[model samples]
Target: MPMDWEAEFVFRAILIGVGATATMDIWAVVMKRAFGVPSLNYGFVGRWLGHMRHGQFAHESIAEAPPIAGEQIIGWSAHYVIGVIFAGLFLFVLGVDWARDPTLLPAVLFGIVTVSAPFFVMQPGMGLGFAAAKAPKSNIARLRSLIAHTSFGFGLFLATWSAAQVFQI
Candidate 1:
Protein backbone atom coordinates (compact mmCIF):
# COMPACT_ATOMS: atom_id res chain seq x y z
CA MET A 1 0.00 0.00 0.00
CA PRO A 2 1.14 3.52 -0.71
CA MET A 3 1.84 5.65 2.37
CA ASP A 4 0.12 8.89 3.16
CA TRP A 5 1.87 12.25 3.07
CA GLU A 6 2.12 13.85 6.47
CA ALA A 7 2.96 17.42 7.31
CA GLU A 8 3.05 16.49 10.94
CA PHE A 9 5.57 13.73 10.39
CA VAL A 10 7.76 16.06 8.43
CA PHE A 11 7.65 18.63 11.18
CA ARG A 12 8.43 15.99 13.76
CA ALA A 13 11.30 14.79 11.65
CA ILE A 14 12.77 18.26 11.74
CA LEU A 15 12.33 18.38 15.47
CA ILE A 16 14.07 15.07 15.72
CA GLY A 17 16.94 16.38 13.65
CA VAL A 18 17.36 19.34 15.91
CA GLY A 19 17.25 17.17 18.97
CA ALA A 20 19.70 14.69 17.53
CA THR A 21 22.24 17.31 16.54
CA ALA A 22 21.96 18.95 19.90
CA THR A 23 22.74 15.55 21.35
CA MET A 24 25.86 15.49 19.20
CA ASP A 25 26.89 18.87 20.50
CA ILE A 26 26.29 17.85 24.06
CA TRP A 27 28.37 14.75 23.57
CA ALA A 28 31.06 16.97 22.17
CA VAL A 29 31.00 19.12 25.28
CA VAL A 30 31.21 16.12 27.56
CA MET A 31 34.17 14.84 25.60
CA LYS A 32 36.03 18.11 25.93
CA ARG A 33 35.38 18.68 29.61
CA ALA A 34 35.98 15.13 30.71
CA PHE A 35 39.13 14.60 28.65
CA GLY A 36 40.57 18.08 28.21
CA VAL A 37 40.44 17.58 24.47
CA PRO A 38 39.59 20.66 22.42
CA SER A 39 36.97 19.05 20.29
CA LEU A 40 34.25 20.99 18.46
CA ASN A 41 31.40 21.31 20.86
CA TYR A 42 28.02 22.68 19.78
CA GLY A 43 28.93 26.09 21.10
CA PHE A 44 32.22 25.81 19.27
CA VAL A 45 30.70 27.25 16.14
CA GLY A 46 28.70 30.02 17.77
CA ARG A 47 31.24 30.95 20.45
CA TRP A 48 34.01 31.37 17.95
CA LEU A 49 31.56 33.77 16.44
CA GLY A 50 31.63 35.87 19.62
CA HIS A 51 35.31 36.49 19.02
CA MET A 52 35.01 37.90 15.52
CA ARG A 53 35.55 41.50 16.55
CA HIS A 54 39.02 40.67 17.85
CA GLY A 55 40.13 38.92 14.64
CA GLN A 56 40.16 35.57 16.40
CA PHE A 57 40.48 32.66 14.03
CA ALA A 58 37.91 29.89 14.21
CA HIS A 59 40.57 27.21 14.15
CA GLU A 60 42.67 28.93 16.73
CA SER A 61 42.69 27.17 20.05
CA ILE A 62 41.04 29.07 22.86
CA ALA A 63 39.70 28.47 26.32
CA GLU A 64 36.25 26.92 26.53
CA ALA A 65 33.59 27.96 28.96
CA PRO A 66 31.13 25.55 30.43
CA PRO A 67 28.53 24.91 27.74
CA ILE A 68 26.49 28.05 27.35
CA ALA A 69 22.77 27.98 27.87
CA GLY A 70 22.10 29.96 24.70
CA GLU A 71 24.30 28.16 22.17
CA GLN A 72 22.59 24.82 22.81
CA ILE A 73 19.23 26.45 22.25
CA ILE A 74 20.25 28.01 18.95
CA GLY A 75 22.28 25.04 17.84
CA TRP A 76 19.40 22.67 18.47
CA SER A 77 17.07 24.94 16.56
CA ALA A 78 19.38 24.93 13.57
CA HIS A 79 19.64 21.16 13.72
CA TYR A 80 15.88 20.68 13.75
CA VAL A 81 15.36 23.04 10.85
CA ILE A 82 18.04 21.34 8.82
CA GLY A 83 16.54 17.95 9.62
CA VAL A 84 13.11 19.10 8.53
CA ILE A 85 14.61 20.22 5.26
CA PHE A 86 16.34 16.90 4.66
CA ALA A 87 13.17 14.97 5.43
CA GLY A 88 11.27 17.27 3.07
CA LEU A 89 13.70 16.54 0.29
CA PHE A 90 13.45 12.84 1.01
CA LEU A 91 9.69 13.14 0.96
CA PHE A 92 9.91 14.87 -2.38
CA VAL A 93 12.08 12.18 -3.85
CA LEU A 94 10.55 9.08 -2.31
CA GLY A 95 7.23 10.66 -1.72
CA VAL A 96 5.48 8.96 1.19
CA ASP A 97 7.61 5.97 0.33
CA TRP A 98 10.59 7.56 2.00
CA ALA A 99 9.55 5.57 4.97
CA ARG A 100 10.39 2.51 2.94
CA ASP A 101 13.57 3.38 1.08
CA PRO A 102 15.26 6.33 2.78
CA THR A 103 18.21 6.16 0.44
CA LEU A 104 21.53 7.19 1.98
CA LEU A 105 22.75 9.05 -1.10
CA PRO A 106 20.20 11.84 -1.07
CA ALA A 107 20.36 12.15 2.69
CA VAL A 108 24.12 12.51 2.52
CA LEU A 109 23.82 15.05 -0.27
CA PHE A 110 21.39 17.09 1.74
CA GLY A 111 23.74 17.04 4.71
CA ILE A 112 26.71 18.17 2.63
CA VAL A 113 24.64 21.04 1.30
CA THR A 114 23.28 21.97 4.72
CA VAL A 115 26.85 22.16 5.98
CA SER A 116 27.64 24.94 3.52
CA ALA A 117 25.60 27.48 5.43
CA PRO A 118 27.87 27.28 8.48
CA PHE A 119 30.95 27.00 6.34
CA PHE A 120 30.06 30.22 4.58
CA VAL A 121 28.72 32.37 7.38
CA MET A 122 29.73 31.02 10.80
CA GLN A 123 33.12 29.73 9.75
CA PRO A 124 34.23 33.00 8.25
CA GLY A 125 32.75 35.01 11.07
CA MET A 126 34.63 32.81 13.51
CA GLY A 127 37.81 33.33 11.47
CA LEU A 128 38.08 29.76 10.25
CA GLY A 129 38.29 31.16 6.73
CA PHE A 130 35.60 29.58 4.61
CA ALA A 131 34.09 26.71 6.58
CA ALA A 132 37.28 26.10 8.52
CA ALA A 133 39.05 25.64 5.20
CA LYS A 134 41.42 28.52 5.83
CA ALA A 135 43.19 27.04 8.81
CA PRO A 136 46.88 26.27 8.37
CA LYS A 137 46.03 22.88 9.89
CA SER A 138 42.44 22.71 8.76
CA ASN A 139 42.50 19.60 6.62
CA ILE A 140 41.87 17.15 9.43
CA ALA A 141 39.36 19.24 11.31
CA ARG A 142 37.47 20.04 8.13
CA LEU A 143 37.31 16.39 7.14
CA ARG A 144 36.25 15.32 10.59
CA SER A 145 33.45 17.87 10.67
CA LEU A 146 32.33 16.78 7.23
CA ILE A 147 32.29 13.16 8.28
CA ALA A 148 30.35 14.01 11.43
CA HIS A 149 27.72 15.91 9.50
CA THR A 150 27.42 13.13 6.97
CA SER A 151 26.90 10.72 9.80
CA PHE A 152 24.17 13.00 10.99
CA GLY A 153 22.48 12.72 7.61
CA PHE A 154 22.69 8.96 7.78
CA GLY A 155 21.25 9.02 11.25
CA LEU A 156 18.34 11.12 10.03
CA PHE A 157 17.44 8.69 7.29
CA LEU A 158 17.58 5.73 9.63
CA ALA A 159 15.64 7.39 12.39
CA THR A 160 12.92 8.77 10.13
CA TRP A 161 12.49 5.47 8.39
CA SER A 162 12.33 3.63 11.65
CA ALA A 163 9.96 6.11 13.21
CA ALA A 164 7.66 5.88 10.26
CA GLN A 165 7.41 2.16 10.79
CA VAL A 166 7.15 2.24 14.59
CA PHE A 167 4.42 4.85 14.47
CA GLN A 168 2.80 2.77 11.75
CA ILE A 169 2.11 5.90 9.80
Candidate 2:
Protein backbone atom coordinates (compact mmCIF):
# COMPACT_ATOMS: atom_id res chain seq x y z
CA MET A 1 0.00 0.00 0.00
CA PRO A 2 2.83 2.42 0.80
CA MET A 3 4.53 1.61 -2.50
CA ASP A 4 1.30 2.13 -4.36
CA TRP A 5 0.79 5.45 -2.63
CA GLU A 6 4.30 6.56 -3.53
CA ALA A 7 3.85 5.63 -7.15
CA GLU A 8 0.53 7.45 -7.35
CA PHE A 9 2.05 10.49 -5.75
CA VAL A 10 4.91 10.66 -8.23
CA PHE A 11 2.62 10.11 -11.20
CA ARG A 12 0.20 12.79 -10.08
CA ALA A 13 2.93 15.34 -9.56
CA ILE A 14 4.26 14.85 -13.08
CA LEU A 15 0.77 15.07 -14.49
CA ILE A 16 0.10 18.29 -12.65
CA GLY A 17 3.33 19.84 -13.88
CA VAL A 18 2.83 18.81 -17.49
CA GLY A 19 -0.78 19.86 -17.55
CA ALA A 20 0.01 23.24 -16.02
CA THR A 21 2.86 23.88 -18.42
CA ALA A 22 0.67 23.02 -21.38
CA THR A 23 -1.88 25.50 -20.13
CA MET A 24 0.73 28.21 -19.76
CA ASP A 25 2.01 27.58 -23.28
CA ILE A 26 -1.49 27.81 -24.66
CA TRP A 27 -1.92 31.15 -22.92
CA ALA A 28 1.29 32.41 -24.46
CA VAL A 29 0.10 31.47 -27.93
CA VAL A 30 -3.18 33.26 -27.36
CA MET A 31 -1.43 36.38 -26.11
CA LYS A 32 0.75 36.39 -29.20
CA ARG A 33 -2.02 35.82 -31.75
CA ALA A 34 -4.59 38.04 -30.08
CA PHE A 35 -2.54 40.96 -28.76
CA GLY A 36 0.48 40.98 -31.03
CA VAL A 37 2.41 40.90 -27.78
CA PRO A 38 5.32 38.56 -28.11
CA SER A 39 6.75 36.69 -25.18
CA LEU A 40 10.40 35.89 -24.77
CA ASN A 41 11.42 33.10 -27.08
CA TYR A 42 12.63 29.90 -25.49
CA GLY A 43 15.39 29.86 -28.05
CA PHE A 44 16.81 32.73 -26.10
CA VAL A 45 16.52 30.69 -22.94
CA GLY A 46 18.55 27.98 -24.61
CA ARG A 47 21.04 30.56 -25.76
CA TRP A 48 21.39 31.88 -22.25
CA LEU A 49 21.96 28.41 -20.83
CA GLY A 50 24.41 27.64 -23.57
CA HIS A 51 26.29 30.83 -22.85
CA MET A 52 26.40 30.03 -19.17
CA ARG A 53 28.82 27.24 -19.97
CA HIS A 54 31.32 29.94 -20.97
CA GLY A 55 30.82 31.85 -17.71
CA GLN A 56 28.59 34.46 -19.38
CA PHE A 57 25.92 34.95 -16.75
CA ALA A 58 24.55 38.20 -18.16
CA HIS A 59 23.95 39.35 -21.70
CA GLU A 60 23.58 42.85 -23.09
CA SER A 61 21.06 41.49 -25.55
CA ILE A 62 20.23 37.80 -25.56
CA ALA A 63 18.94 38.07 -29.11
CA GLU A 64 22.25 39.40 -30.29
CA ALA A 65 24.20 36.69 -28.61
CA PRO A 66 25.60 34.07 -30.95
CA PRO A 67 23.27 31.16 -31.45
CA ILE A 68 24.08 27.95 -29.70
CA ALA A 69 23.66 24.43 -30.97
CA GLY A 70 20.36 22.78 -30.09
CA GLU A 71 19.18 25.94 -28.39
CA GLN A 72 15.50 25.50 -29.22
CA ILE A 73 15.54 21.95 -27.94
CA ILE A 74 17.44 22.95 -24.86
CA GLY A 75 15.13 25.85 -24.05
CA TRP A 76 11.91 23.91 -24.57
CA SER A 77 13.22 21.02 -22.52
CA ALA A 78 14.27 23.30 -19.70
CA HIS A 79 10.91 25.06 -19.66
CA TYR A 80 8.99 21.84 -19.08
CA VAL A 81 11.60 20.64 -16.63
CA ILE A 82 11.21 23.80 -14.65
CA GLY A 83 7.47 23.31 -14.58
CA VAL A 84 7.87 19.77 -13.26
CA ILE A 85 10.31 21.01 -10.66
CA PHE A 86 7.82 23.58 -9.46
CA ALA A 87 5.09 20.98 -9.26
CA GLY A 88 7.44 18.79 -7.30
CA LEU A 89 8.09 21.68 -4.98
CA PHE A 90 4.39 22.18 -4.52
CA LEU A 91 3.91 18.55 -3.60
CA PHE A 92 6.92 18.56 -1.36
CA VAL A 93 5.74 21.58 0.60
CA LEU A 94 2.06 20.71 0.81
CA GLY A 95 2.42 16.94 1.05
CA VAL A 96 0.30 14.03 -0.18
CA ASP A 97 -2.80 15.28 1.60
CA TRP A 98 -2.95 18.43 -0.47
CA ALA A 99 -2.47 16.40 -3.60
CA ARG A 100 -5.58 14.41 -2.75
CA ASP A 101 -7.85 17.27 -1.71
CA PRO A 102 -6.21 20.23 -3.50
CA THR A 103 -6.80 23.92 -2.88
CA LEU A 104 -6.80 27.11 -4.92
CA LEU A 105 -5.06 29.65 -2.73
CA PRO A 106 -1.87 27.68 -2.32
CA ALA A 107 -1.67 26.83 -6.01
CA VAL A 108 -2.21 30.46 -6.97
CA LEU A 109 0.37 31.67 -4.48
CA PHE A 110 2.82 29.09 -5.74
CA GLY A 111 2.31 30.28 -9.28
CA ILE A 112 2.86 33.88 -8.28
CA VAL A 113 5.93 32.93 -6.31
CA THR A 114 7.33 31.17 -9.36
CA VAL A 115 7.58 34.59 -11.00
CA SER A 116 10.55 35.46 -8.83
CA ALA A 117 12.79 33.22 -10.91
CA PRO A 118 12.00 34.90 -14.20
CA PHE A 119 11.68 38.42 -12.84
CA PHE A 120 14.86 38.47 -10.80
CA VAL A 121 17.04 35.73 -12.21
CA MET A 122 16.06 34.97 -15.83
CA GLN A 123 15.15 38.52 -16.89
CA PRO A 124 18.29 40.12 -15.49
CA GLY A 125 20.48 37.34 -16.77
CA MET A 126 18.97 37.62 -20.22
CA GLY A 127 19.71 41.34 -20.22
CA LEU A 128 16.08 42.34 -20.34
CA GLY A 129 16.81 44.34 -17.19
CA PHE A 130 15.05 43.89 -13.88
CA ALA A 131 11.45 42.74 -14.41
CA ALA A 132 11.84 43.57 -18.11
CA ALA A 133 12.18 47.27 -17.30
CA LYS A 134 14.38 47.65 -20.38
CA ALA A 135 11.75 46.27 -22.71
CA PRO A 136 9.49 48.58 -24.65
CA LYS A 137 6.60 49.57 -22.41
CA SER A 138 8.17 47.72 -19.54
CA ASN A 139 5.04 47.94 -17.42
CA ILE A 140 3.10 46.01 -20.00
CA ALA A 141 5.70 43.28 -20.06
CA ARG A 142 5.66 43.04 -16.29
CA LEU A 143 1.88 42.87 -16.23
CA ARG A 144 1.83 40.18 -18.86
CA SER A 145 4.32 38.16 -16.91
CA LEU A 146 2.23 38.44 -13.78
CA ILE A 147 -0.88 37.43 -15.66
CA ALA A 148 0.89 34.51 -17.26
CA HIS A 149 2.25 33.28 -13.97
CA THR A 150 -1.15 33.60 -12.40
CA SER A 151 -2.56 31.56 -15.23
CA PHE A 152 0.00 28.90 -14.44
CA GLY A 153 -1.40 28.86 -10.92
CA PHE A 154 -4.84 28.27 -12.30
CA GLY A 155 -3.42 25.53 -14.45
CA LEU A 156 -1.98 23.81 -11.41
CA PHE A 157 -5.31 23.89 -9.64
CA LEU A 158 -7.10 22.65 -12.72
CA ALA A 159 -4.64 19.83 -13.15
CA THR A 160 -4.95 18.79 -9.57
CA TRP A 161 -8.71 18.81 -9.82
CA SER A 162 -8.53 16.74 -12.96
CA ALA A 163 -6.30 14.24 -11.22
CA ALA A 164 -8.63 14.06 -8.26
CA GLN A 165 -11.48 13.35 -10.58
CA VAL A 166 -9.55 10.56 -12.24
CA PHE A 167 -8.70 8.97 -8.93
CA GLN A 168 -12.16 9.73 -7.64
CA ILE A 169 -10.57 11.25 -4.60
Candidate 3:
Protein backbone atom coordinates (compact mmCIF):
# COMPACT_ATOMS: atom_id res chain seq x y z
CA MET A 1 0.00 0.00 0.00
CA PRO A 2 2.95 2.37 0.44
CA MET A 3 5.11 3.86 -2.30
CA ASP A 4 8.38 2.11 -1.65
CA TRP A 5 10.97 1.87 -4.41
CA GLU A 6 10.47 -1.88 -4.28
CA ALA A 7 7.50 -3.99 -3.31
CA GLU A 8 9.08 -7.00 -1.71
CA PHE A 9 11.22 -5.21 0.88
CA VAL A 10 10.54 -2.46 3.38
CA PHE A 11 13.72 -2.74 5.40
CA ARG A 12 15.39 -0.11 3.24
CA ALA A 13 13.42 2.64 4.91
CA ILE A 14 14.82 1.69 8.30
CA LEU A 15 18.27 1.68 6.78
CA ILE A 16 17.74 5.17 5.46
CA GLY A 17 16.71 6.55 8.83
CA VAL A 18 19.66 4.92 10.55
CA GLY A 19 22.06 6.15 7.88
CA ALA A 20 20.74 9.68 8.07
CA THR A 21 21.15 9.80 11.82
CA ALA A 22 24.70 8.55 11.44
CA THR A 23 25.50 11.17 8.83
CA MET A 24 24.32 13.94 11.14
CA ASP A 25 26.42 12.62 14.01
CA ILE A 26 29.51 12.49 11.84
CA TRP A 27 28.86 15.95 10.53
CA ALA A 28 28.39 17.26 14.04
CA VAL A 29 31.68 15.81 15.14
CA VAL A 30 33.53 17.18 12.13
CA MET A 31 32.01 20.59 12.63
CA LYS A 32 32.87 20.65 16.29
CA ARG A 33 36.45 19.50 15.84
CA ALA A 34 37.28 21.60 12.83
CA PHE A 35 35.32 24.74 13.62
CA GLY A 36 35.42 24.84 17.45
CA VAL A 37 31.69 24.34 17.71
CA PRO A 38 30.22 22.27 20.52
CA SER A 39 28.08 19.36 19.41
CA LEU A 40 27.17 16.13 21.21
CA ASN A 41 27.65 15.98 24.94
CA TYR A 42 27.54 13.01 27.29
CA GLY A 43 25.82 15.00 29.98
CA PHE A 44 23.43 12.16 30.58
CA VAL A 45 26.15 10.44 32.56
CA GLY A 46 26.52 13.47 34.79
CA ARG A 47 22.79 13.88 35.07
CA TRP A 48 22.25 10.31 36.09
CA LEU A 49 24.94 10.64 38.69
CA GLY A 50 23.28 13.72 39.99
CA HIS A 51 19.98 11.92 40.29
CA MET A 52 21.57 9.05 42.18
CA ARG A 53 22.97 11.49 44.71
CA HIS A 54 20.00 13.78 45.01
CA GLY A 55 17.21 11.22 44.69
CA GLN A 56 15.47 13.76 42.51
CA PHE A 57 15.01 13.44 38.81
CA ALA A 58 16.89 16.09 36.93
CA HIS A 59 17.40 16.96 33.31
CA GLU A 60 20.61 16.15 31.47
CA SER A 61 22.91 19.12 31.36
CA ILE A 62 25.40 20.12 28.71
CA ALA A 63 29.11 19.89 29.37
CA GLU A 64 31.10 23.05 29.86
CA ALA A 65 34.52 21.64 29.13
CA PRO A 66 36.45 22.40 26.00
CA PRO A 67 36.09 19.68 23.38
CA ILE A 68 38.92 17.17 23.22
CA ALA A 69 39.76 14.18 21.01
CA GLY A 70 38.30 11.56 23.32
CA GLU A 71 35.27 13.67 24.00
CA GLN A 72 34.62 13.97 20.31
CA ILE A 73 34.75 10.24 19.77
CA ILE A 74 32.50 9.33 22.64
CA GLY A 75 30.10 12.15 22.07
CA TRP A 76 29.80 11.51 18.37
CA SER A 77 29.26 7.82 18.91
CA ALA A 78 26.37 8.52 21.24
CA HIS A 79 24.99 11.05 18.82
CA TYR A 80 25.02 8.55 15.99
CA VAL A 81 23.34 5.91 18.07
CA ILE A 82 20.58 8.25 19.10
CA GLY A 83 20.00 9.27 15.53
CA VAL A 84 19.82 5.69 14.33
CA ILE A 85 17.37 4.70 17.05
CA PHE A 86 15.11 7.64 16.39
CA ALA A 87 15.06 6.98 12.69
CA GLY A 88 14.46 3.32 13.30
CA LEU A 89 11.36 4.15 15.28
CA PHE A 90 10.06 6.33 12.48
CA LEU A 91 10.62 3.57 9.98
CA PHE A 92 8.80 1.13 12.20
CA VAL A 93 5.84 3.47 12.38
CA LEU A 94 5.82 3.84 8.61
CA GLY A 95 5.92 0.06 8.30
CA VAL A 96 8.86 -1.87 6.85
CA ASP A 97 7.18 -2.50 3.53
CA TRP A 98 6.14 1.12 3.14
CA ALA A 99 9.65 2.15 4.08
CA ARG A 100 11.17 0.31 1.14
CA ASP A 101 9.54 2.93 -1.01
CA PRO A 102 10.25 5.85 1.33
CA THR A 103 9.94 9.27 -0.18
CA LEU A 104 12.02 12.23 0.91
CA LEU A 105 8.94 14.06 2.05
CA PRO A 106 7.87 11.64 4.78
CA ALA A 107 11.37 10.91 5.95
CA VAL A 108 12.24 14.60 6.27
CA LEU A 109 8.99 15.33 7.99
CA PHE A 110 9.73 12.56 10.40
CA GLY A 111 13.06 14.19 11.20
CA ILE A 112 11.32 17.44 11.99
CA VAL A 113 8.79 15.67 14.16
CA THR A 114 11.39 13.72 16.08
CA VAL A 115 13.45 16.82 16.74
CA SER A 116 10.83 17.86 19.27
CA ALA A 117 12.04 15.19 21.64
CA PRO A 118 15.42 16.86 21.85
CA PHE A 119 13.87 20.28 22.00
CA PHE A 120 11.80 19.40 24.99
CA VAL A 121 14.17 17.14 26.86
CA MET A 122 17.65 18.28 25.92
CA GLN A 123 17.46 21.94 24.95
CA PRO A 124 15.93 23.18 28.18
CA GLY A 125 18.32 21.13 30.24
CA MET A 126 21.11 22.83 28.35
CA GLY A 127 19.46 26.11 29.42
CA LEU A 128 18.00 26.86 26.06
CA GLY A 129 14.26 27.31 25.86
CA PHE A 130 12.01 24.80 24.23
CA ALA A 131 13.40 24.13 20.76
CA ALA A 132 16.40 26.40 21.16
CA ALA A 133 14.02 29.31 21.39
CA LYS A 134 15.60 31.05 24.37
CA ALA A 135 19.17 30.82 23.28
CA PRO A 136 20.96 34.10 23.51
CA LYS A 137 23.39 35.34 20.89
CA SER A 138 20.18 34.87 19.04
CA ASN A 139 20.56 35.37 15.31
CA ILE A 140 23.43 33.06 14.52
CA ALA A 141 22.43 30.40 17.03
CA ARG A 142 18.89 30.36 15.69
CA LEU A 143 20.12 30.06 12.15
CA ARG A 144 22.46 27.29 13.18
CA SER A 145 19.65 25.32 14.80
CA LEU A 146 17.46 25.69 11.75
CA ILE A 147 20.24 24.60 9.43
CA ALA A 148 21.11 21.67 11.65
CA HIS A 149 17.58 20.31 11.62
CA THR A 150 17.31 20.82 7.88
CA SER A 151 20.57 18.97 7.40
CA PHE A 152 19.22 16.09 9.44
CA GLY A 153 16.20 15.94 7.19
CA PHE A 154 18.35 15.89 4.08
CA GLY A 155 20.54 13.24 5.63
CA LEU A 156 17.49 11.08 6.22
CA PHE A 157 16.55 11.31 2.57
CA LEU A 158 20.10 10.48 1.49
CA ALA A 159 20.27 7.51 3.85
CA THR A 160 17.03 6.18 2.48
CA TRP A 161 18.34 6.50 -1.05
CA SER A 162 21.59 4.76 -0.19
CA ALA A 163 19.80 1.94 1.61
CA ALA A 164 17.47 1.39 -1.30
CA GLN A 165 20.45 1.06 -3.61
CA VAL A 166 22.31 -1.26 -1.30
CA PHE A 167 19.30 -3.46 -0.55
CA GLN A 168 18.20 -3.42 -4.19
CA ILE A 169 14.74 -2.69 -2.94
Tens-digit per-residue lDDT, 9-87, candidate 1: 5654665465445544555566569966465544654455444445664443423423334765555455556656665
User: On lDDT, who's better, 2 or 3?
Assistant: 2
Worst 10 residues of 2 by lDDT: 1-10
- Cα distance off (Å), candidate 3, residue 135: 2.4
User: What local lDDT does model 2 show for residue 127?
Assistant: 86
Candidate 3 C-alpha lDDT tens digits along 1-169: 5445443333554466567866666677878889887764554434433444445433433454223345445545656666767766766677665544668888678767766765676666555657766666645565555556666877887877676666654
For all candidates, the clash counts are 2, 0, 4
Q: Model 3: residues >4 Å from true position, as ranges? A: 1-14, 25-61, 64-74
- Which portions of model 2 show Cα errors greater than 4 Å? 1-6
Which prediction has the highest lDDT against the true structure?
2
Tens digit of per-residue lDDT, candidate 2, span 37-143: 78768999999999999999999999999999999999999988998889988888998688788899999999999988889999999988999989778898788
- What TM-score would candidate 3 get against the native? 0.64
Worst 10 residues of 3 by lDDT: 58-67
Each candidate: RMSD to true structure?
A: 5.6, 1.7, 5.8
Clashing pairs in 3: 4-101, 5-101, 10-96, 16-160
Model 2: colliding residue pairs: none
